[model samples]
Target: MPAEPLEKGQTRFALRAPSARRVAVVIEGEAHPMNRDPDGLYSAEFGAPAGTLYRFRVTTGGGEELEVPDPASRFQPEDVHGPSEVVDTRAFGRPDAGWRGRPWHETVLYELHVGAFTPEGTYEAAAGKLDHLRDLGVTAVELMPLSDFPGGRNWGYDGVLPYAPDSSYGRPESLRAFAAAAHERGIQVFLDVVYNHFGPDGNYLSAYAPEFFTDRHETPWGAAINMDGRGSGYVREFFIRNALYWLSDYGLDGLRLDAVHAILDDSPEHFLTELARRVQEGPGAGRHVHLLLENEENEASRLLGGGSSDSVYTAQWNDDIHHALHVSATGEGASYYSDFADAPVARLGRCLAEGFAFQGDPSQHRGNARGEPSGHLSPLRFVSLLQNHDQVGNRAFGDRISESVSSEVVRAVAAVYLLAPQVPMLFMGEEWAASSPFQFFCDFDGDLARLVTEGRRREFQKFPEFSEEATRERIPDPSDEQTFLDSKLVWDERGDLENAEILDFYTDALAVRRAEIVPRLEGIPGTGAQQRLVGERGLRVQWPLADGSLLSLLANLSEKESGGFEPPPGRLIFATNDTGPDDTGNLSAWTVAWYLLENNS
Candidate 1:
């Protein structure tokens, strides 16, 4: 919720610091001490006008004084280390006031990082491009994290102040305007948020409330957040409120929680359950407020309605489908790719027909069983994608698959996910096969910059390709401005012939999905989709409709063309390679075709 500027130009301030002996609201070098309650909350009303900058002067254990930004700051116009500005989020008018968000099953998400989305990289500039996405059949724009970070350029996962929108993206209202512009074009907007751990730089929670973090468990970042430890109820409320704030204040349609697997909690009722419950019971009760999760563990229970009635998330990112497609496109079996290479096409077939490929099955790559049975769940419960931030940015060179695979492979993969029953997502520039790379870029300074650059290079030492001296030197510096500049998308190339061809493929596939597939699949309910391997690497899928008709897909995964496979006697709708029956009817190598099998009975 936004702070209310009371009458007489005084603003009420509050801080939840259980361990603080004294707290003061400092405005322009003037300090006004606050009153502490028995419940450990310190608050005071001061004669500070709206937009007045303020910071907390807290006395912690042992009487150490520290100045820090408010944990629930509505706006941080300066750097994260600077004071917070009082923002009346309600003052901004909702541009698309009549827009009620769409349902989960209707979403066709296009993910992009605002900084590298365009040259200007501001919300206004990004909003100007919504027409392109809207024309391409994108229903929503899943922005990469926009929370306040240390510097101007970042991937946004390193955000510290979760409540404040990054000043580099313009004011908070700019983001609201961006969302409204998207809504005007009939597109929904959502944000990716990081709650597992705060970034290393600009973090100040420990100074006043060290209990916000705990050593009970370890995550890849370090000690996990105090989600279920002593005094953790307050910490949980902080994040739960953050979730509601984004939806209610910015008019955002939803939120994508990053890496829920890393959020360690052992309570009887998980924090995620609590978050869902509170959101549905609070301001989001009557809205189409969707919650998406990025759970790397492939956990399906939470998504399969194991949580409370109102606590289940709409869906989760299906990395299994992406891994299978990546392995099939390029036979790179390093790291996490190893588990997906054995029978890549078969694995993809499973994901296309079912929700997960590894459901409580042993993972040869992880040396243990992974995932849970999700076949009983709806196919829309998964968000399938070809290229995303992690898949591209995690590479040693931060190269997209477009840089790695042939144009034919890109078209085939695009057709697979776009036409599948699951909700489809396209990374920015993926539609036109943009040439620019989306690298791991940042703007950290001094020792932290050096450490980040060195650590990024060192982290890849496990791979033989990155360990070599020559390859190591080729790695882009994460802290370099040039690296950040290199990641910007080139909007002019959308019309180039080669790029246009791929873009046409995406557009045509999406058009077909909207006009033909979605209505039939969503209107009627069954097992969603049924699939059978046509050959060693070919798959034939049948999606039954309400009228007993079937929408079929035939795909060839091998490089060599094979013959003698026929559709169930219906209209031939679309084809990638334009290959038909080889006198006996076969699909060409790396080709995908869709057919509408009408009910003849």
Candidate 2:
């Protein structure tokens, strides 16, 4: 029989397990013992009203207790697995305003974290920063996940609730407000959704539906989500429903799925394909509903996912690019950095032109062959970024690309990333080069909190600047007001001459894109791409620009050597480092230059 429709403040729930005893509904401020009927539903009445806080406290015979937040709670306040909050999601919502814009290919993607995007660290506060995003020339805002996780502040990846938004960001209504506001500004809102696994805490899908998990596989967190195991069908339904809720109810333009590599599902029908079919045939039929992934393996098959998607997504974040640039620019050679330093600049150029620097190459870091060539897929199906949250936050010292490398190198790489065929993503405060460390910190339950600290430290003990003790010592307290404050963007710093220059450089590049390139060379078939070594520590890249012109990219890898590039006699459009050889033809240190060929057709 179909379940009864819920009215405001009313939720009907049931569990079939006969072995279970002592079931209670956790309502706002108190726990109410449920009345179990032969029909199997254990329910209770609550005067707690709409937007009440709750979670289920279920106990078994052995005195073992499990606290699972409401399976369908509208919000998670304590964290992803923490106490659940009742919210009339529909009450705080409007009609799905719908995406009214161009395709995702033309988008200027901007990635931001709600906690650090503004001082208030809430959805409402993030809404205020939208104007700044607009001024920065970004057309789409790719938010970090808002799914429930423990504590008010987190990176948002450890979310347990498949549907609820973190209450720390504001009520469910505020997310709708953000999406609406972004649409009003001609900007698309792309939400980051994680379905790989739920948080270690407050997870209760197994009790409600035994088929939502599998014993076949496990992830770093714990048991993986039940997508292919028993109850796989319902698990898929739960996720699809959650995604549809965000899109249809909140009016998100797109959803950037997180860590798809960890989504270990072996179902025959395949959940990804089915979800894609449902979405495309639904309200977002005409406009783009991007499904991005952060797959480390670079499996082209997942992107192709049987074409259920419009090609696996508009793009996937290229961690290879980030890693390569980090090693080259920062001169860091601890762990994964080892594989990148030995990588050739020619490989990076091929990635810029063809997308995949390590396609089929033996990856020292992963100890296996990695990635398919970008030539195997559409150029638009990749997102190139020099810096992102995890790349910075997961660091021993949590240093951003801006802090470790010279602004010159940062600007140089930015040019390549923006001009490349793939979509480009910018972390918050990257534009003004704000000095803030987005470290990995969490506030868990008392017993589990200690485990998290020890676990985190143990994972990084092998790395050079990372000791278990040092790692624990630096773990920022999530409850501390200053941790969030430390991540806020200093908008006024743009007034400083150095930052002003970087800001101007970015503006000019983007203006050139909007006014000139978009009109003249939109998605120009990148060609004549060839690169060569200039001795042991330097290399040069040549790109065939318009009208028989050439753009030369130069980088000096060694501390002692300076690199040079000889243009085919034309004006210098931009330079990423020391002024490339002056008119007298003397190259500067680690210079990266873009010069047009004298159009002598």
Q: Considering every candidate listed, which one attains the maximal TM-score?
A: 1
lDDT for position 295 in model 1: 90
lDDT of 2 at 476: 58
- Give each model's whole-structure lDDT: 0.86, 0.67
- Candidate 1 regions off by >4 Å? 1-3, 304-311, 523-528, 546-548, 579-583, 598-601
TM-score of each: 0.96, 0.84
Worst 10 residues of 1 by lDDT: 302-311
Candidate number of the best lDDT:
1
Candidate 1's error at 168, in angstroms? 0.7
> In candidate 2, which residue pairs get closer than 3 Å at backbone N, Cα or C atoms, i.e. clash?
79-149, 79-150, 80-148, 80-149, 80-150, 315-381, 581-586
Per-residue lDDT over 274-337 for candidate 2, one digit per residue giving the tens place of the 0 to 100 score:
7766776874686667777787777666564223333545567877777766676776766766
- lDDT accuracy of residue 214 in candidate 1: 97
